[model samples]
Target: MFGSLGAVTLLVSAVLGQGFATPKANGTSGYELKQGPLDTPWTEKVGTTPWPEYPRPQMARSEWRNLNGVWQYRNASGGESEMERPPFRQELESSVLVPFCLESALSGVMGNYTIHSWYRTTFNVPDSWTERVLLNFAAVDYQATVFVNEKQVANHTGGYWAFNIDITDQLNKNGTNELVVFVFDPTNLWPYNVPIGKQKLIPEHIFYTPCSGIWQTVWLESAPADSIEKLHINAGADGKVDITVHTTSNTTTTADFILYEPNSELVKLKIKVPVNKAHSFVVDSPQLWSPDSPTLYNITVKLGSDAVQSYTGFRTISKGVVNGVQRPLLNGEFVFMFGTLDQGYWPDGLHSPPSFDAMVSDLKVLKEVGYNMVRKHIKVEPALFYQAADQLGLMLIQDMPALSTSSVFINDETAKQCPGVSLTPSLDPDTVQKEFDRQLAVMVNQLKSYPSIVTWVIYNEGWGQPWEGNDGVRNTSIDGILTDYVRKIDPTRLIDSVTGWHDHGAGDFYDNHHYSSPQCGTPWYSTPSSPYNSETDHRIAIQGEFGGIGQNVSEEHAWKVAASINAINNTYELDATPKIWNLRAHMILQELEFQIQEYACSGAVWTQTTDVEGEVNGMLTYDRRVNRMDKDMWRRDIQGLYEAAARRARTNGTMGVEGRGGGGG
Candidate 1:
């Protein structure tokens, strides 16, 4: 009776205390909290256990349990027996809230000792219906080995993607079950290189303080023996949809696909298709997904006794030479892709956000500021973040976190300690290369279904970009090989082979970066030495990064600058206050008008949306306390650029200010 559902609810509620609510989290954003947790509107709601929202919205289940409250924690060693067998009965000394990493302020263990850590939590399976039970971690940094009831369940590498463990056989028939997770994240330390995107142990400019351990949601859900394993939806060029459903069962089974137009929630079509096969459906008038009208179709997939609620949108991305310039064509028209470099980091929670609503607030700000896309810079966010963009109509440029070895960010001690290891990305170890290949494949496969993500950036400024697969030899074809690999996986979206420089002239876009390009003083102004070689470059030209104007240096929310400030220039300095805010609006609006005129620069991404650590050149402060520029004013100014760009696109685009939706096949 103690393991009953009612008892479990009471235990979960009691375990998550209201004591974690801070004053700054009380809907007050200003100069209130110095060196404390910054509050968004959703912060006050984050009690002890934050991000209680369902981790997987794409494949949502009605009945599930959240195992995020009152997790026991302890520091572990790789050589210790705790790696294989958990410290079962003995209580872990410290208590850390689930999801928040050990290095985060909200974790209660904000200590920098992030090498090895252990997390243990307990949950009960509802006795009503249980064919099989699944344990899912939204993400775990670096490497994690999970144990369910003293039995090792999963061993996963790479830190930025989701993984699951079926603990059906390992779970107890009655009473409660114990779940222990072991996480090892060396970050960008010295000798161990992994897919670390902007996460540095030293925590300087551009690189943020490393987050380790379970940084996303943890939950337990019951599934059928023949449950849906994965669903891949492709909203095609002809405006029809092809859904490939993969189920857990190997035997032949038919799944009922009931599609509902999400806008009206009306059943538009229904079909019963065999599992593990791609099925296409054509509608009379398909509601295409665009930045203006993001139409999603809700679908309920039922396989005998198992059913899941899922959603998908209909759209396509292609490229063509429009008006003598190669540009990205959205749904057969040239639509400008303007967005911010969203470094999905939180000051309080590090990689994990304060709350689900906090993530929504960031997207709303971008939409309000007239941005149509978000280049998720160097980090992978929870599935809900992409889902949020899908619903909000924001296109995303998802970056595969840089795959690095510990030797890449070497110090004096590391150089002396690991004398034999290769330091450069050109000569990464074989294991690291294999891991990158596995992780990259997983990232593309897992995230390919999301409608909002129109581009997958393979490399960023050559962080972990290996020159060659061979022994330290340089080869540019390696760049093309990676691009080819991504295209081979999902040929639906545009591929930016390299974001900034070190671009080996690969991928769909010839992307470039600068501090504040196309401005008067910058080198991008005059056509003589412009970064964009649109006249000769085979690929479409785009400004992957620019307009990094700084603000709010002295405010309480500003992340203090460390030893390095590479982008700061003496050519023309920017004020870290309102002066820059006014100037930021003026500079970007003016430069963009010129950039969009000739169609040479097809699209552009600003430096960032929010300041991360020492990088203060963001539209908003790091903690999101201050909006340096006025959203309405900025929106009022940039609204015309979209129309002009679309007009200059293909002849298919209308000249008037409008939505980018059209009826296809």
Candidate 2:
């Protein structure tokens, strides 16, 4: 095999022209790569193919295979080789790690191309488990075709949603079975490339390196012919939680739900309900979940022969008048959400984290820094990320990866091309809006159960939305349609219809994104005079994005921050050799305090959680190595801002409603 220690040494020399001793993969069935910059403990502890933990924590089954180690890979572009036998191709070019993008260094194949990348591996089914075998993929970029024993089994066409194939008939009972996958991601090559978030083939400013092919986990599970497939558990504030189970078996089955507090004693209780019916359980004196306490009740549901583990928190989100202003209420009280934007990117694992612990570490930073929410900008993270957020008591504002007729970059060039327009993707409006809608529905259904997700952003600056009328202006009718459509699906959370730029007077909150200098003395409020304000419609005010204060890390790693200088005030310089890192740090802290304490702000999401590729506006660096702002100094102020919101709610006095807006004016 080409993945042995000796082969690793040879491979490293061949790839990077460097000779180094090959280290063993941490107690797993693969070789570890030579260390890269920004490697975390999880990155070092990555066993075999990185994400070794259970991929799906919300619906976790113990009986599953982690098919995420070394696999034979070859560029399937006009290669003269056999595609139907063992090893697949006669001359397999290289070995790549499964679930990591080929472009990523962690994958062991650092080539970044959009052509068909064929992945081949073999796995044996346990003889004891014999009813049915299912092959699952957490996500594959663009499109993928699966083959079992050289026979086509299934095909999927979404980059952000999970798909599965019932390979029961395709599996070989006697010995190991050959599995092959072909993936083609056109990226922004065509109009109908699907919503790829910030992926760009040419990778410059905001658009990042393209994450091509399987960027998540691939696994196999065996289940009874008739068994539980999916579980949707919605928790409520009234000491009750609702469970809906989707089963594959038609015969009678009972769902046994066991509850625990996740402590040393492991105290437990059980509730049994019919598999096909919706069941509700009243948790007597349930401890409500919040960012401060973060209380969670563990749940283990067993349906016939299939059992999965999940957890839920008793919390609710609503909109009402508070302190004479419209605000988002948490558990029936006004609570301000203060957080940063999380892109969920890694230095090694682009979309996928280096390991489960690595992903958890990102959330732990937010919890420790006194943040209550994370606006997941334009990326739907893996299930475990959400599970961690739930357990950590961090709320989320998830954004739909914007689709487009063509590539649209949010830049000054775009601003000039389409004046006064925030989002405009239609060169010739592609007919893939249906696909975007389908993926949106999938995203909502896939992540609705997690208690931490409090909002869904449908159209971000009108990425690939309809431009039917008014010179690329956003159509309020379309905004209303999408808002109502998403509301029907999950009415538990608030919806930000069109974040920033265009405002259609729809959705629950008026979201605005600004990067201007802050007014320190004044506490800004959302009034009817604002651009997004409506005369007839009433919604809460939220500073969706603000304060992108750029600070140069160093001369070697400051290109992105230098480029971002033009986006802010003219007074700010593009100092390539900036010596004072503390100057920008002071400005950022003061601006953040102002944004968080704004009189009319119910929530505020800072520019970002970390510095992405070139945009150096994150609180943390791209590698999760450095916190630009001192944690101890910022933590107290951040915590105090949240406390202020709660204090205002308590002392809110009577005020006459002079306008249509909800609470604060």
Q: How many clashing pairs does model 1 include?
A: 5
lDDT of each: 0.71, 0.68
Put down candidate 2 lDDT per residue, 456-510, tens digits, no spaces: 9998766666766568555568788889999998888899988775677789987
On TM-score, the leading prediction is 1
TM-score computed on alpha carbons, candidate 1: 0.86
TM-scores, all candidates, are: 0.86, 0.83
lDDT of 2: 0.68
Q: Which ten residues in a row have the lowest lDDT in candidate 1?
A: 17-26
Q: Compared with the true structure, what per-residue lDDT tens digits does model 1 show for residues 1-665?
A: 11211222233334431212112212223111123344344445566756666677677765677776557777774433657657775567777766776777677777564677887766677886468888888899978988888888899887888888889899886877777788888776556677888776665556667889998887777788889988887876575777788988776778998887654557888888788877887765777889888777777888888887777788898899887778788788888888999998887788888876787788988988788999998888988788788888899999999865344343343233323244554334677767887888899998998899999998887777665544865567767888899999998999998887577778998777766654311225333224555556768777787777665455466544434344343213366557556666565655665556644667778777887766677777777877777655567556666766766564433323342232111
Which ten-residue region of model 2 has the weakest summed lDDT? 656-665
Indicate the residue-level lDDT of 614 in model 1.
63
Q: Cα RMSD for candidate 1?
A: 7.7
